[model samples]
Target: MKVLNKGLKFAPTKKIDKFGVFVDLQKFKRSLCLKKYFLKDPVTRQVLGENDGWRHTELKKKSHFYPKHLISKEITTFETMVLDEMEKIQPMRSQNLTKEEKEALKELAEDTTITIKPADKGGGIVILNREDYDEESLRILNDRDVYQRIPYNPTEEIKKKFDKYIQKGENNEFLNEKETDYLTVKYPKIPVFYHLPKVHKNLNKPPGRPIVSGIDSISSKVAEYLDHLLQPIVRKIPSYLKDTGDIIRSLNTITWEENFLLVTCDVRSLYTNIPHNRGCEAIKTMLLEDGEIKKEQIDYIVEGIALIL
Candidate 1:
Protein backbone atom coordinates (compact mmCIF):
# COMPACT_ATOMS: atom_id res chain seq x y z
CA MET A 1 0.00 0.00 0.00
CA LYS A 2 2.81 2.39 0.77
CA VAL A 3 4.38 1.66 -2.59
CA LEU A 4 1.03 1.92 -4.36
CA ASN A 5 0.16 5.15 -2.63
CA LYS A 6 3.51 6.58 -3.60
CA GLY A 7 3.06 5.39 -7.18
CA LEU A 8 -0.38 6.94 -7.42
CA LYS A 9 0.85 10.24 -5.96
CA PHE A 10 3.60 10.26 -8.55
CA ALA A 11 1.23 9.66 -11.46
CA PRO A 12 -2.44 10.04 -10.54
CA THR A 13 -3.63 9.32 -14.07
CA LYS A 14 -1.46 6.21 -14.38
CA LYS A 15 -3.72 3.18 -14.33
CA ILE A 16 -3.05 0.31 -11.98
CA ASP A 17 -2.76 -3.08 -13.59
CA LYS A 18 -2.97 -5.25 -10.51
CA PHE A 19 -5.16 -7.94 -12.00
CA GLY A 20 -2.40 -10.48 -12.40
CA VAL A 21 -0.82 -10.32 -8.97
CA PHE A 22 0.26 -12.89 -6.39
CA VAL A 23 2.18 -16.16 -6.37
CA ASP A 24 1.40 -19.76 -5.42
CA LEU A 25 4.44 -21.79 -4.61
CA GLN A 26 5.12 -25.11 -3.04
CA LYS A 27 7.81 -25.04 -0.36
CA PHE A 28 10.26 -26.96 -2.52
CA LYS A 29 9.40 -24.69 -5.44
CA ARG A 30 10.22 -21.45 -3.63
CA SER A 31 13.89 -21.88 -4.46
CA LEU A 32 13.05 -21.84 -8.14
CA CYS A 33 11.40 -18.44 -7.86
CA LEU A 34 14.11 -17.14 -5.53
CA LYS A 35 16.70 -18.42 -8.00
CA LYS A 36 14.99 -16.43 -10.73
CA TYR A 37 14.76 -13.26 -8.65
CA PHE A 38 18.36 -13.56 -7.50
CA LEU A 39 19.44 -13.97 -11.08
CA LYS A 40 17.20 -11.32 -12.57
CA ASP A 41 16.59 -8.74 -9.83
CA PRO A 42 18.55 -10.24 -6.94
CA VAL A 43 16.91 -7.77 -4.61
CA THR A 44 14.27 -8.89 -2.19
CA ARG A 45 13.35 -7.53 1.21
CA GLN A 46 10.53 -9.99 1.90
CA VAL A 47 12.04 -13.40 1.19
CA LEU A 48 14.76 -15.25 3.05
CA GLY A 49 13.69 -18.89 3.13
CA GLU A 50 16.05 -20.82 0.84
CA ASN A 51 19.52 -19.51 0.36
CA ASP A 52 21.35 -21.53 -2.27
CA GLY A 53 24.60 -19.63 -1.99
CA TRP A 54 26.47 -22.38 -3.84
CA ARG A 55 24.33 -21.95 -6.93
CA HIS A 56 24.95 -18.20 -6.87
CA THR A 57 28.68 -18.82 -6.54
CA GLU A 58 28.52 -21.35 -9.36
CA LEU A 59 26.79 -18.95 -11.73
CA LYS A 60 29.37 -17.43 -14.04
CA LYS A 61 29.63 -13.67 -13.88
CA LYS A 62 27.14 -12.94 -16.60
CA SER A 63 24.31 -10.47 -17.19
CA HIS A 64 21.70 -12.46 -15.30
CA PHE A 65 20.47 -9.97 -12.74
CA TYR A 66 20.02 -6.31 -12.08
CA PRO A 67 21.64 -5.43 -8.78
CA LYS A 68 19.62 -3.30 -6.40
CA HIS A 69 19.26 -2.32 -2.70
CA LEU A 70 22.58 -2.01 -0.92
CA ILE A 71 24.34 -4.00 -3.62
CA SER A 72 22.92 -1.65 -6.17
CA LYS A 73 23.50 1.41 -4.02
CA GLU A 74 27.16 0.48 -4.10
CA ILE A 75 27.06 -0.95 -7.62
CA THR A 76 24.04 0.04 -9.65
CA THR A 77 22.55 -1.58 -12.76
CA PHE A 78 22.76 -5.06 -14.29
CA GLU A 79 26.14 -4.64 -15.91
CA THR A 80 27.48 -3.95 -12.45
CA MET A 81 25.77 -7.08 -11.17
CA VAL A 82 27.43 -9.16 -13.86
CA LEU A 83 30.86 -7.72 -13.20
CA ASP A 84 30.62 -7.97 -9.43
CA GLU A 85 29.57 -11.60 -9.60
CA MET A 86 32.50 -12.29 -11.90
CA GLU A 87 35.10 -10.47 -9.80
CA LYS A 88 33.97 -12.15 -6.55
CA ILE A 89 34.21 -15.55 -8.25
CA GLN A 90 37.81 -15.19 -9.51
CA PRO A 91 39.58 -15.97 -6.21
CA MET A 92 37.55 -18.84 -4.73
CA ARG A 93 35.87 -20.11 -7.89
CA SER A 94 38.12 -22.72 -9.48
CA GLN A 95 39.57 -24.66 -6.53
CA ASN A 96 40.08 -23.97 -2.85
CA LEU A 97 43.63 -22.91 -3.57
CA THR A 98 45.84 -19.95 -2.92
CA LYS A 99 49.03 -18.95 -4.88
CA GLU A 100 50.23 -22.47 -3.99
CA GLU A 101 47.10 -24.00 -5.60
CA LYS A 102 48.15 -23.22 -9.17
CA GLU A 103 51.60 -24.71 -8.63
CA ALA A 104 50.00 -27.86 -7.21
CA LEU A 105 47.62 -27.97 -10.15
CA LYS A 106 50.58 -27.86 -12.55
CA GLU A 107 52.42 -30.59 -10.67
CA LEU A 108 49.34 -32.83 -10.56
CA ALA A 109 48.32 -32.34 -14.20
CA GLU A 110 51.71 -33.53 -15.55
CA ASP A 111 51.29 -37.05 -14.11
CA THR A 112 49.66 -39.98 -15.92
CA THR A 113 46.92 -39.31 -13.37
CA ILE A 114 45.40 -42.19 -11.53
CA THR A 115 41.93 -41.37 -10.24
CA ILE A 116 40.75 -41.20 -6.61
CA LYS A 117 37.82 -40.08 -4.56
CA PRO A 118 38.08 -38.07 -1.40
CA ALA A 119 34.31 -38.05 -1.74
CA ASP A 120 32.16 -38.70 -4.76
CA LYS A 121 31.41 -35.67 -6.94
CA GLY A 122 32.33 -35.54 -10.64
CA GLY A 123 34.33 -32.29 -10.85
CA GLY A 124 37.85 -31.19 -10.02
CA ILE A 125 39.10 -34.29 -8.21
CA VAL A 126 42.57 -35.13 -9.57
CA ILE A 127 45.44 -37.22 -8.23
CA LEU A 128 48.95 -35.87 -8.90
CA ASN A 129 50.95 -38.27 -11.03
CA ARG A 130 54.12 -39.93 -9.78
CA GLU A 131 55.44 -39.86 -13.38
CA ASP A 132 56.12 -36.87 -15.63
CA TYR A 133 52.96 -34.86 -16.16
CA ASP A 134 50.77 -36.09 -18.99
CA GLU A 135 50.58 -32.97 -21.17
CA GLU A 136 47.32 -34.25 -22.71
CA SER A 137 45.69 -34.72 -19.33
CA LEU A 138 47.38 -31.56 -18.04
CA ARG A 139 45.78 -29.55 -20.84
CA ILE A 140 42.32 -30.59 -19.81
CA LEU A 141 43.08 -30.10 -16.12
CA ASN A 142 44.82 -26.78 -16.66
CA ASP A 143 41.99 -25.61 -18.86
CA ARG A 144 39.64 -26.11 -15.96
CA ASP A 145 42.31 -24.70 -13.58
CA VAL A 146 41.22 -26.86 -10.67
CA TYR A 147 41.79 -30.39 -9.37
CA GLN A 148 41.82 -32.29 -6.09
CA ARG A 149 42.72 -35.88 -5.41
CA ILE A 150 43.35 -38.63 -2.90
CA PRO A 151 44.87 -41.89 -4.07
CA TYR A 152 42.32 -44.73 -4.31
CA ASN A 153 42.63 -48.06 -6.06
CA PRO A 154 40.73 -48.75 -9.29
CA THR A 155 37.85 -49.95 -7.17
CA GLU A 156 37.27 -46.51 -5.73
CA GLU A 157 38.13 -44.57 -8.91
CA ILE A 158 35.89 -46.82 -10.98
CA LYS A 159 33.10 -46.42 -8.49
CA LYS A 160 33.66 -42.67 -8.38
CA LYS A 161 33.56 -42.42 -12.16
CA PHE A 162 30.45 -44.54 -12.44
CA ASP A 163 28.70 -42.62 -9.68
CA LYS A 164 29.75 -39.32 -11.19
CA TYR A 165 28.59 -40.47 -14.59
CA ILE A 166 25.21 -41.22 -13.11
CA GLN A 167 25.26 -37.95 -11.19
CA LYS A 168 26.08 -36.05 -14.33
CA GLY A 169 23.08 -37.70 -15.87
CA GLU A 170 21.07 -36.52 -12.90
CA ASN A 171 22.47 -33.01 -13.21
CA ASN A 172 22.09 -32.51 -16.95
CA GLU A 173 20.36 -35.19 -18.93
CA PHE A 174 18.20 -38.28 -18.37
CA LEU A 175 14.41 -38.37 -18.67
CA ASN A 176 13.94 -35.73 -15.97
CA GLU A 177 13.18 -32.41 -17.70
CA LYS A 178 13.29 -30.20 -14.59
CA GLU A 179 17.04 -30.73 -14.27
CA THR A 180 17.87 -27.43 -15.97
CA ASP A 181 14.39 -26.11 -15.61
CA TYR A 182 15.83 -22.98 -14.02
CA LEU A 183 16.72 -21.73 -17.45
CA THR A 184 13.66 -20.52 -19.37
CA VAL A 185 14.76 -21.73 -22.76
CA LYS A 186 14.71 -24.03 -25.76
CA TYR A 187 13.06 -26.92 -24.01
CA PRO A 188 10.62 -25.61 -21.41
CA LYS A 189 9.57 -29.26 -20.93
CA ILE A 190 6.04 -27.92 -20.74
CA PRO A 191 5.02 -30.15 -23.66
CA VAL A 192 5.22 -27.08 -25.92
CA PHE A 193 8.26 -26.21 -28.02
CA TYR A 194 9.75 -23.01 -29.36
CA HIS A 195 10.76 -22.77 -33.01
CA LEU A 196 13.89 -20.72 -32.29
CA PRO A 197 17.49 -21.59 -31.40
CA LYS A 198 19.11 -21.63 -27.94
CA VAL A 199 20.26 -18.65 -25.99
CA HIS A 200 23.61 -17.35 -24.46
CA LYS A 201 24.11 -19.13 -27.80
CA ASN A 202 26.43 -16.38 -28.98
CA LEU A 203 27.47 -13.61 -26.60
CA ASN A 204 28.50 -11.73 -29.72
CA LYS A 205 25.08 -11.77 -31.35
CA PRO A 206 24.00 -8.17 -32.01
CA PRO A 207 23.56 -6.73 -28.50
CA GLY A 208 24.23 -10.10 -26.92
CA ARG A 209 22.00 -13.06 -26.17
CA PRO A 210 18.65 -12.54 -27.83
CA ILE A 211 15.84 -12.14 -25.38
CA VAL A 212 13.41 -15.08 -25.32
CA SER A 213 10.44 -13.46 -27.07
CA GLY A 214 7.56 -15.02 -25.24
CA ILE A 215 5.37 -14.73 -22.19
CA ASP A 216 6.89 -14.84 -18.71
CA SER A 217 5.99 -18.51 -19.31
CA ILE A 218 3.27 -20.92 -18.23
CA SER A 219 2.11 -24.48 -18.90
CA SER A 220 1.73 -25.84 -22.43
CA LYS A 221 -2.00 -25.24 -22.31
CA VAL A 222 -1.59 -21.76 -20.82
CA ALA A 223 1.12 -21.08 -23.35
CA GLU A 224 -1.21 -22.09 -26.20
CA TYR A 225 -3.87 -19.79 -24.74
CA LEU A 226 -1.30 -17.01 -24.40
CA ASP A 227 -0.29 -17.43 -27.99
CA HIS A 228 -3.87 -16.96 -29.01
CA LEU A 229 -4.09 -13.85 -26.81
CA LEU A 230 -0.92 -12.49 -28.42
CA GLN A 231 -2.26 -12.79 -31.98
CA PRO A 232 -3.60 -9.25 -31.91
CA ILE A 233 -0.36 -7.89 -30.39
CA VAL A 234 1.52 -9.59 -33.21
CA ARG A 235 -0.71 -8.41 -36.08
CA LYS A 236 -1.22 -4.83 -34.91
CA ILE A 237 2.44 -3.81 -34.72
CA PRO A 238 3.64 -1.76 -37.69
CA SER A 239 5.04 -4.16 -40.29
CA TYR A 240 8.22 -2.13 -40.76
CA LEU A 241 8.92 -2.38 -37.04
CA LYS A 242 8.17 -6.10 -37.07
CA ASP A 243 11.63 -6.94 -38.36
CA THR A 244 13.17 -5.08 -35.45
CA GLY A 245 10.96 -6.16 -32.60
CA ASP A 246 13.18 -4.34 -30.20
CA ILE A 247 11.30 -1.20 -31.16
CA ILE A 248 7.86 -2.73 -31.40
CA ARG A 249 5.58 -3.79 -28.57
CA SER A 250 4.73 -7.46 -28.96
CA LEU A 251 1.55 -7.47 -26.86
CA ASN A 252 0.42 -3.88 -27.43
CA THR A 253 -3.18 -4.48 -26.39
CA ILE A 254 -5.03 -6.57 -23.85
CA THR A 255 -7.92 -8.85 -24.61
CA TRP A 256 -9.71 -8.36 -21.26
CA GLU A 257 -9.69 -4.54 -21.56
CA GLU A 258 -7.98 -4.72 -18.21
CA ASN A 259 -5.23 -2.34 -17.20
CA PHE A 260 -2.45 -4.51 -15.82
CA LEU A 261 -0.26 -3.37 -12.98
CA LEU A 262 3.10 -2.09 -14.07
CA VAL A 263 4.32 -4.46 -11.38
CA THR A 264 5.99 -7.67 -12.47
CA CYS A 265 4.92 -10.80 -10.62
CA ASP A 266 6.48 -14.21 -10.09
CA VAL A 267 4.63 -17.40 -9.27
CA ARG A 268 6.15 -20.69 -8.23
CA SER A 269 5.29 -24.36 -8.79
CA LEU A 270 3.24 -23.63 -11.85
CA TYR A 271 3.62 -26.81 -13.83
CA THR A 272 1.56 -28.15 -16.73
CA ASN A 273 -0.52 -30.03 -14.19
CA ILE A 274 -1.58 -26.78 -12.49
CA PRO A 275 -4.58 -24.76 -13.64
CA HIS A 276 -3.85 -21.41 -15.28
CA ASN A 277 -6.53 -19.46 -13.43
CA ARG A 278 -5.44 -20.95 -10.12
CA GLY A 279 -1.92 -19.74 -10.72
CA CYS A 280 -3.16 -16.29 -11.70
CA GLU A 281 -5.37 -16.01 -8.62
CA ALA A 282 -2.48 -17.02 -6.43
CA ILE A 283 -0.41 -14.14 -7.74
CA LYS A 284 -3.27 -11.71 -7.19
CA THR A 285 -3.76 -12.72 -3.58
CA MET A 286 -0.11 -12.49 -2.77
CA LEU A 287 0.05 -8.83 -3.76
CA LEU A 288 -3.34 -7.69 -2.43
CA GLU A 289 -3.07 -9.03 1.10
CA ASP A 290 0.55 -8.38 1.89
CA GLY A 291 0.14 -7.19 5.52
CA GLU A 292 -2.69 -9.54 6.36
CA ILE A 293 -0.28 -12.37 5.64
CA LYS A 294 1.84 -11.19 8.54
CA LYS A 295 -1.21 -10.75 10.77
CA GLU A 296 -2.51 -14.24 10.10
CA GLN A 297 0.91 -15.86 9.80
CA ILE A 298 -0.19 -17.55 6.63
CA ASP A 299 2.07 -20.01 4.86
CA TYR A 300 4.09 -17.82 2.53
CA ILE A 301 4.11 -20.48 -0.15
CA VAL A 302 0.36 -20.31 -0.74
CA GLU A 303 0.05 -16.71 0.48
CA GLY A 304 -0.67 -15.59 -3.04
CA ILE A 305 -4.08 -17.24 -3.00
CA ALA A 306 -5.40 -15.29 0.01
CA LEU A 307 -7.76 -12.89 -1.68
CA ILE A 308 -11.44 -11.96 -1.23
CA LEU A 309 -12.18 -11.75 -4.94
Candidate 2:
Protein backbone atom coordinates (compact mmCIF):
# COMPACT_ATOMS: atom_id res chain seq x y z
CA MET A 1 0.00 0.00 0.00
CA LYS A 2 2.99 2.31 -0.08
CA VAL A 3 2.69 5.13 -2.64
CA LEU A 4 4.68 8.10 -3.88
CA ASN A 5 3.89 11.52 -5.31
CA LYS A 6 6.70 10.69 -7.78
CA GLY A 7 6.83 14.09 -9.51
CA LEU A 8 8.93 16.98 -8.19
CA LYS A 9 7.63 18.48 -4.96
CA PHE A 10 6.71 21.70 -6.78
CA ALA A 11 4.73 19.90 -9.45
CA PRO A 12 0.99 20.49 -9.74
CA THR A 13 -1.49 17.89 -8.41
CA LYS A 14 -2.75 17.21 -11.91
CA LYS A 15 0.62 15.61 -12.68
CA ILE A 16 0.63 12.90 -9.98
CA ASP A 17 -0.67 9.35 -9.96
CA LYS A 18 -4.35 8.55 -9.43
CA PHE A 19 -4.29 4.90 -8.34
CA GLY A 20 -1.14 5.44 -6.36
CA VAL A 21 -1.82 3.27 -3.31
CA PHE A 22 -2.71 4.74 0.10
CA VAL A 23 -2.05 2.85 3.33
CA ASP A 24 -4.61 3.26 6.11
CA LEU A 25 -2.54 2.74 9.21
CA GLN A 26 -5.64 2.29 11.43
CA LYS A 27 -7.61 -0.07 9.31
CA PHE A 28 -9.87 -2.64 10.97
CA LYS A 29 -9.97 -6.37 10.05
CA ARG A 30 -6.29 -6.48 9.19
CA SER A 31 -5.15 -7.65 12.63
CA LEU A 32 -5.82 -11.37 12.05
CA CYS A 33 -4.12 -11.21 8.70
CA LEU A 34 -1.10 -9.69 10.35
CA LYS A 35 -1.12 -12.21 13.22
CA LYS A 36 -1.17 -15.14 10.81
CA TYR A 37 1.72 -13.64 8.92
CA PHE A 38 3.67 -13.03 12.12
CA LEU A 39 3.17 -16.66 13.19
CA LYS A 40 4.56 -17.80 9.85
CA ASP A 41 7.33 -15.26 9.29
CA PRO A 42 10.26 -16.17 11.56
CA VAL A 43 11.63 -12.63 11.19
CA THR A 44 8.44 -11.20 12.73
CA ARG A 45 6.52 -11.91 15.90
CA GLN A 46 3.74 -9.33 16.25
CA VAL A 47 1.07 -7.38 14.40
CA LEU A 48 -0.14 -3.94 15.51
CA GLY A 49 -3.59 -2.38 15.90
CA GLU A 50 -5.15 0.39 17.97
CA ASN A 51 -6.64 -2.11 20.41
CA ASP A 52 -7.29 -5.79 20.87
CA GLY A 53 -10.34 -6.91 18.89
CA TRP A 54 -11.98 -10.23 18.03
CA ARG A 55 -12.88 -9.27 14.45
CA HIS A 56 -9.21 -8.58 13.78
CA THR A 57 -8.30 -12.08 14.88
CA GLU A 58 -11.12 -13.54 12.82
CA LEU A 59 -9.63 -12.26 9.58
CA LYS A 60 -6.20 -13.88 9.95
CA LYS A 61 -6.53 -15.89 6.78
CA LYS A 62 -6.20 -12.81 4.56
CA SER A 63 -2.92 -13.53 2.81
CA HIS A 64 -1.72 -10.02 2.03
CA PHE A 65 -1.56 -8.33 5.41
CA TYR A 66 1.28 -7.84 7.89
CA PRO A 67 1.27 -7.20 11.61
CA LYS A 68 0.50 -3.68 12.83
CA HIS A 69 0.48 -2.48 16.46
CA LEU A 70 -2.14 -1.81 19.12
CA ILE A 71 -1.53 1.23 21.35
CA SER A 72 -2.25 1.78 25.07
CA LYS A 73 -4.63 4.20 26.78
CA GLU A 74 -2.53 5.14 29.82
CA ILE A 75 -2.31 8.79 28.85
CA THR A 76 -5.97 9.31 29.70
CA THR A 77 -5.44 8.15 33.26
CA PHE A 78 -2.53 10.37 34.39
CA GLU A 79 -4.69 13.05 35.99
CA THR A 80 -6.43 10.45 38.12
CA MET A 81 -3.14 8.97 39.29
CA VAL A 82 -1.73 12.40 40.04
CA LEU A 83 -4.82 13.27 42.09
CA ASP A 84 -4.61 10.04 44.08
CA GLU A 85 -0.99 10.80 44.95
CA MET A 86 -1.85 14.36 45.94
CA GLU A 87 -4.37 13.35 48.65
CA LYS A 88 -2.11 10.81 50.38
CA ILE A 89 0.59 13.47 50.73
CA GLN A 90 -1.29 15.74 53.23
CA PRO A 91 -1.56 13.07 56.00
CA MET A 92 1.85 11.42 55.77
CA ARG A 93 3.63 14.69 54.92
CA SER A 94 2.33 16.26 58.17
CA GLN A 95 3.28 13.18 60.20
CA ASN A 96 6.85 11.93 60.70
CA LEU A 97 9.29 12.08 57.75
CA THR A 98 12.92 10.93 57.86
CA LYS A 99 15.47 13.76 57.95
CA GLU A 100 16.49 13.03 54.37
CA GLU A 101 12.86 12.81 53.28
CA LYS A 102 12.04 16.06 55.16
CA GLU A 103 14.98 17.75 53.48
CA ALA A 104 13.70 16.54 50.12
CA LEU A 105 10.20 17.77 50.93
CA LYS A 106 11.61 21.11 52.06
CA GLU A 107 13.51 21.40 48.81
CA LEU A 108 10.36 20.47 46.91
CA ALA A 109 8.32 23.09 48.80
CA GLU A 110 10.90 25.83 48.36
CA ASP A 111 11.03 25.11 44.66
CA THR A 112 7.23 24.83 44.41
CA THR A 113 5.11 27.66 42.97
CA ILE A 114 1.36 28.13 43.00
CA THR A 115 -0.78 27.77 39.88
CA ILE A 116 -4.59 28.30 40.06
CA LYS A 117 -6.37 25.99 37.65
CA PRO A 118 -9.77 25.11 36.20
CA ALA A 119 -12.00 22.54 37.83
CA ASP A 120 -15.54 21.19 37.57
CA LYS A 121 -16.81 22.15 41.09
CA GLY A 122 -15.17 25.59 41.17
CA GLY A 123 -16.87 28.86 40.33
CA GLY A 124 -16.77 29.97 36.71
CA ILE A 125 -13.57 28.58 35.17
CA VAL A 126 -10.47 30.76 35.44
CA ILE A 127 -6.71 30.43 36.09
CA LEU A 128 -4.24 32.57 37.99
CA ASN A 129 -0.56 32.72 38.82
CA ARG A 130 1.24 34.80 41.42
CA GLU A 131 4.79 34.95 42.76
CA ASP A 132 3.41 33.22 45.81
CA TYR A 133 0.05 31.77 46.86
CA ASP A 134 -2.55 33.98 48.49
CA GLU A 135 -4.77 32.89 51.39
CA GLU A 136 -7.98 33.63 49.43
CA SER A 137 -6.81 31.64 46.40
CA LEU A 138 -5.49 28.83 48.58
CA ARG A 139 -8.75 28.51 50.53
CA ILE A 140 -10.73 28.43 47.29
CA LEU A 141 -8.29 25.96 45.71
CA ASN A 142 -8.40 23.78 48.84
CA ASP A 143 -12.21 23.85 48.70
CA ARG A 144 -12.42 23.09 44.99
CA ASP A 145 -9.39 20.91 44.11
CA VAL A 146 -7.59 21.84 40.91
CA TYR A 147 -4.95 20.04 38.93
CA GLN A 148 -1.56 21.51 39.75
CA ARG A 149 2.07 20.66 40.22
CA ILE A 150 5.22 22.30 41.51
CA PRO A 151 6.57 24.38 38.65
CA TYR A 152 9.74 26.38 38.78
CA ASN A 153 9.06 30.06 39.39
CA PRO A 154 11.02 32.14 36.92
CA THR A 155 14.06 34.00 38.24
CA GLU A 156 13.61 37.75 38.59
CA GLU A 157 15.72 38.32 35.48
CA ILE A 158 13.50 36.09 33.34
CA LYS A 159 10.35 37.62 34.85
CA LYS A 160 11.55 41.13 34.00
CA LYS A 161 12.18 40.15 30.39
CA PHE A 162 8.82 38.40 30.15
CA ASP A 163 7.01 41.56 31.29
CA LYS A 164 7.45 43.04 27.84
CA TYR A 165 5.09 40.48 26.41
CA ILE A 166 2.26 41.82 28.59
CA GLN A 167 0.58 45.13 27.89
CA LYS A 168 1.90 47.97 29.99
CA GLY A 169 -1.54 48.93 31.29
CA GLU A 170 -3.14 45.50 31.18
CA ASN A 171 -3.85 43.59 34.34
CA ASN A 172 -2.14 40.21 34.68
CA GLU A 173 -2.68 38.40 31.40
CA PHE A 174 -0.83 36.00 29.13
CA LEU A 175 -1.01 33.17 31.61
CA ASN A 176 0.39 29.90 30.24
CA GLU A 177 -2.72 28.42 31.81
CA LYS A 178 -4.34 29.69 28.65
CA GLU A 179 -2.00 27.43 26.74
CA THR A 180 -2.65 24.68 29.26
CA ASP A 181 -6.36 25.31 28.98
CA TYR A 182 -7.56 22.30 27.07
CA LEU A 183 -10.09 19.50 27.57
CA THR A 184 -9.12 15.99 26.53
CA VAL A 185 -11.38 13.00 26.21
CA LYS A 186 -10.06 9.61 25.26
CA TYR A 187 -10.96 8.94 21.68
CA PRO A 188 -13.52 6.23 21.13
CA LYS A 189 -11.62 5.48 17.95
CA ILE A 190 -8.38 3.53 17.86
CA PRO A 191 -5.19 4.65 16.17
CA VAL A 192 -3.45 2.20 13.85
CA PHE A 193 -0.07 0.72 14.89
CA TYR A 194 -1.29 -0.11 18.37
CA HIS A 195 0.19 -3.50 19.26
CA LEU A 196 3.68 -4.64 18.24
CA PRO A 197 5.65 -7.52 19.76
CA LYS A 198 8.92 -6.99 21.58
CA VAL A 199 11.06 -7.75 18.56
CA HIS A 200 8.94 -5.61 16.25
CA LYS A 201 8.99 -2.63 18.61
CA ASN A 202 12.58 -3.41 19.69
CA LEU A 203 11.56 -2.83 23.27
CA ASN A 204 12.10 -5.03 26.30
CA LYS A 205 8.72 -4.32 27.83
CA PRO A 206 5.20 -3.65 26.55
CA PRO A 207 5.83 0.10 26.50
CA GLY A 208 3.42 1.16 29.25
CA ARG A 209 -0.15 2.29 28.47
CA PRO A 210 -2.31 5.28 27.41
CA ILE A 211 -0.30 5.49 24.21
CA VAL A 212 -1.64 5.35 20.63
CA SER A 213 -1.00 3.78 17.25
CA GLY A 214 0.60 5.59 14.32
CA ILE A 215 0.62 4.98 10.54
CA ASP A 216 3.29 6.11 8.16
CA SER A 217 3.58 7.57 4.61
CA ILE A 218 -0.12 8.46 4.28
CA SER A 219 -1.38 10.74 1.50
CA SER A 220 -1.95 14.46 1.90
CA LYS A 221 -5.44 13.84 0.61
CA VAL A 222 -6.06 11.77 3.73
CA ALA A 223 -4.81 14.61 5.89
CA GLU A 224 -7.14 17.05 4.18
CA TYR A 225 -9.97 14.60 4.64
CA LEU A 226 -9.28 14.14 8.35
CA ASP A 227 -8.79 17.86 8.95
CA HIS A 228 -12.53 18.34 8.61
CA LEU A 229 -13.44 15.28 10.67
CA LEU A 230 -11.14 15.58 13.70
CA GLN A 231 -10.93 18.61 15.93
CA PRO A 232 -8.88 21.37 17.60
CA ILE A 233 -11.57 23.58 16.15
CA VAL A 234 -9.25 23.87 13.19
CA ARG A 235 -6.07 21.84 12.97
CA LYS A 236 -3.05 21.83 10.72
CA ILE A 237 -3.93 18.28 9.76
CA PRO A 238 -1.70 18.25 6.71
CA SER A 239 1.25 19.55 8.70
CA TYR A 240 0.59 17.10 11.53
CA LEU A 241 0.54 14.25 9.04
CA LYS A 242 3.76 15.33 7.42
CA ASP A 243 5.47 15.97 10.75
CA THR A 244 4.33 12.60 12.12
CA GLY A 245 5.33 10.81 8.95
CA ASP A 246 8.70 12.55 8.97
CA ILE A 247 9.37 11.22 12.45
CA ILE A 248 8.37 7.65 11.53
CA ARG A 249 10.32 7.84 8.28
CA SER A 250 13.36 9.04 10.19
CA LEU A 251 13.10 5.91 12.32
CA ASN A 252 13.18 3.91 9.07
CA THR A 253 10.64 1.25 10.07
CA ILE A 254 10.65 -1.72 7.75
CA THR A 255 7.12 -3.28 7.42
CA TRP A 256 7.53 -5.33 4.30
CA GLU A 257 9.67 -8.21 3.10
CA GLU A 258 8.00 -9.01 -0.20
CA ASN A 259 5.32 -7.94 -2.74
CA PHE A 260 2.94 -10.95 -3.08
CA LEU A 261 1.10 -9.98 0.12
CA LEU A 262 -1.39 -7.22 -0.59
CA VAL A 263 -2.14 -5.04 2.43
CA THR A 264 -5.77 -3.97 2.20
CA CYS A 265 -6.60 -0.84 4.12
CA ASP A 266 -9.02 1.85 3.04
CA VAL A 267 -8.81 5.39 4.29
CA ARG A 268 -11.54 6.00 6.89
CA SER A 269 -13.25 8.26 4.43
CA LEU A 270 -11.95 8.25 0.87
CA TYR A 271 -14.74 10.31 -0.69
CA THR A 272 -13.38 13.64 0.46
CA ASN A 273 -10.23 15.38 -0.82
CA ILE A 274 -10.38 13.44 -4.06
CA PRO A 275 -10.17 16.50 -6.27
CA HIS A 276 -11.61 15.43 -9.60
CA ASN A 277 -8.75 16.90 -11.58
CA ARG A 278 -6.13 16.12 -8.96
CA GLY A 279 -7.30 12.55 -8.62
CA CYS A 280 -6.69 12.11 -12.30
CA GLU A 281 -3.26 13.68 -11.94
CA ALA A 282 -2.39 11.46 -8.99
CA ILE A 283 -3.54 8.38 -10.85
CA LYS A 284 -0.93 9.43 -13.40
CA THR A 285 2.56 10.23 -12.16
CA MET A 286 2.93 8.74 -8.66
CA LEU A 287 5.23 5.67 -8.39
CA LEU A 288 8.26 4.02 -6.81
CA GLU A 289 11.74 4.05 -8.37
CA ASP A 290 11.28 0.50 -9.64
CA GLY A 291 8.01 1.60 -11.22
CA GLU A 292 7.78 5.14 -12.56
CA ILE A 293 5.24 7.25 -14.42
CA LYS A 294 6.82 9.23 -17.22
CA LYS A 295 6.02 12.92 -17.83
CA GLU A 296 4.01 12.15 -20.94
CA GLN A 297 1.95 9.52 -19.05
CA ILE A 298 0.76 12.11 -16.49
CA ASP A 299 -1.83 13.52 -18.92
CA TYR A 300 -3.28 10.10 -19.62
CA ILE A 301 -3.61 9.19 -15.96
CA VAL A 302 -5.33 12.47 -15.15
CA GLU A 303 -7.58 11.98 -18.13
CA GLY A 304 -8.50 8.48 -16.98
CA ILE A 305 -9.40 9.68 -13.49
CA ALA A 306 -11.41 12.62 -14.86
CA LEU A 307 -14.45 10.36 -15.46
CA ILE A 308 -14.33 8.67 -12.05
CA LEU A 309 -13.96 11.93 -10.21
Task: Quote each prediction's TM-score.
Answer: 0.15, 0.14
Report the lDDT of model 1 for residue 282.
56
The global Cα lDDT (0 to 1) of model 1 is 0.32
The segments of candidate 1 whose C-alpha lies over 4 angstroms from its true place after superposition are 1-105, 120-309
lDDT tens per residue, model 2, 1-309: 011122413212233222231122233225544555556765634542224221011111124443544222442254346545554543222334457866864564564352322222222222222332243334433432222443664334332332332222122221122111211111223233211121222222211111133221112222222232223322333334346577678447657665647444657225543556665444343421213223332232233234223
Worst 10 residues of 2 by lDDT: 178-187
**Deviation (Å) of 290 in candidate 2:** 12
